[model samples]
Target: MNEVRHFWLGISCLIFKVSKTFRYVDTDNELEKQVGGYEHIVVRCPIKIVDENIVETVQKLPRGTIPGDFLDAIVVGMDMLIKKFGSSNKGKTHLCLITDAQYPIKEPYEGTKEDQVDIISQQMKAHGMKLDCIITIGKLSKAINQKILAENDHLLSQFSRKGVAKMRHVGTPTSLLGALRTRTISSVAIFKDEKVVQGSSEERLL
Candidate 1:
């Protein structure tokens, strides 16, 4: 758990350095229960990144006491982004999902996990929000679900040809750091042209 939390904090700080706006959501099952339900995906911080305090706040976020459903979390995140930047052509908008692919879809979901992924991908396409994923490997557990990981990789590849999504599978903390740094530095150029272009670092991952 510490490994996962620290990796995420490092990514958040790196993003804070390069991004003008940042928002965070914790999909922890315990948190969801306390907040009333999974539907209430809380934004731990505001949309605007004012200063270093945002980084500090993110750093202090609690580690998940229980596993969370990434699919449900993705749905809520997509809805928030769609509401906030509906069809706007102003700035680049993206949702980066960092996970270990441990938790699969649980009960109470509207449809099958594949169906949810399809819906989420379509919503991302319609809203014009890029979906980037940093899928950490071997950090959480040895029993990581291969099925979920494969499904997630497929979803990550859904819009890669169009530069709508990018994914990195990192097996160590050092690699994770390098991936996040590379992403933060290259994101603007990647999204500015609306296509990753040939020979780019992101394209090599596809």
Candidate 2:
């Protein structure tokens, strides 16, 4: 009876129950910026479930109305999450956009997908969480610059530790059934591929 539908690719899906007990230390302050530090953070991930066959309800709307409505729903979700979480640190936000990969975004100009990715990557760089990297992990691949992946690799290195993860590994889903089953709760893995681990924040530094 799970309602969630994961993506079609190999992506898994789960959510973390972020807490202050397991929160990273913040060396960065308004007066000084720390090179390596962790603190309370924020994220704004966009998601779209997989589906084929246009709906009759969608057909009733104007050409642009369908997408516009879905987008509004995303914003509403953001507002709700913000209220649940504490305040956002300045405007630094962690953004993850889960899309159908094949779905094309109509950019204002003729710039390629690579161009858009680069722009967002740079913006994420300024934010420093490296959470802005777009995870196009499913069948819906973006026609983007491979160089963007390299950039993401390097940026992610900043978050590396010598050993295991301090938090859980909640992945994006690959199918509708998997999505519904995946918990909107905390999960974890010691080594990235050793075993698909799951647990709570109390099992810290697993």
Best by lDDT: 1
lDDT of 2: 0.24
1-206 per-residue lDDT for model 2 (tens digits)? 01111111111111111111222431111111332222221111112221221122122212211111111112222333333333432232222222222222234245754454454445334433222112324332354445643553333333333111011222343331222222232332110000112333322111
**Model 2 misplacement above 4 A:** 1-92, 132-206
Give Cα distance to truth, residue 44, candidate 1, Å.
Answer: 1.2
What is the Cα-based lDDT of residue 160 in candidate 1?
Answer: 63
Q: What TM-score against the true fold does each predicted structure earn?
A: 0.59, 0.27
* Lowest-sum lDDT 10-residue window in model 2: 188-197
Clashing pairs in 1: none
Worst 10 residues of 1 by lDDT: 188-197
Model 1 Cα lDDT, one tens digit per residue, 136-184: 7764555666786576566556546546567778787567545533332
TM-score leader: 1
- After superposition on all CA atoms, how large is the RMSD of candidate 1? 9.0
**Which parts of model 1 are misplaced by more than 4 Å?**
1-41, 49-59, 107-110, 139-163, 181-206
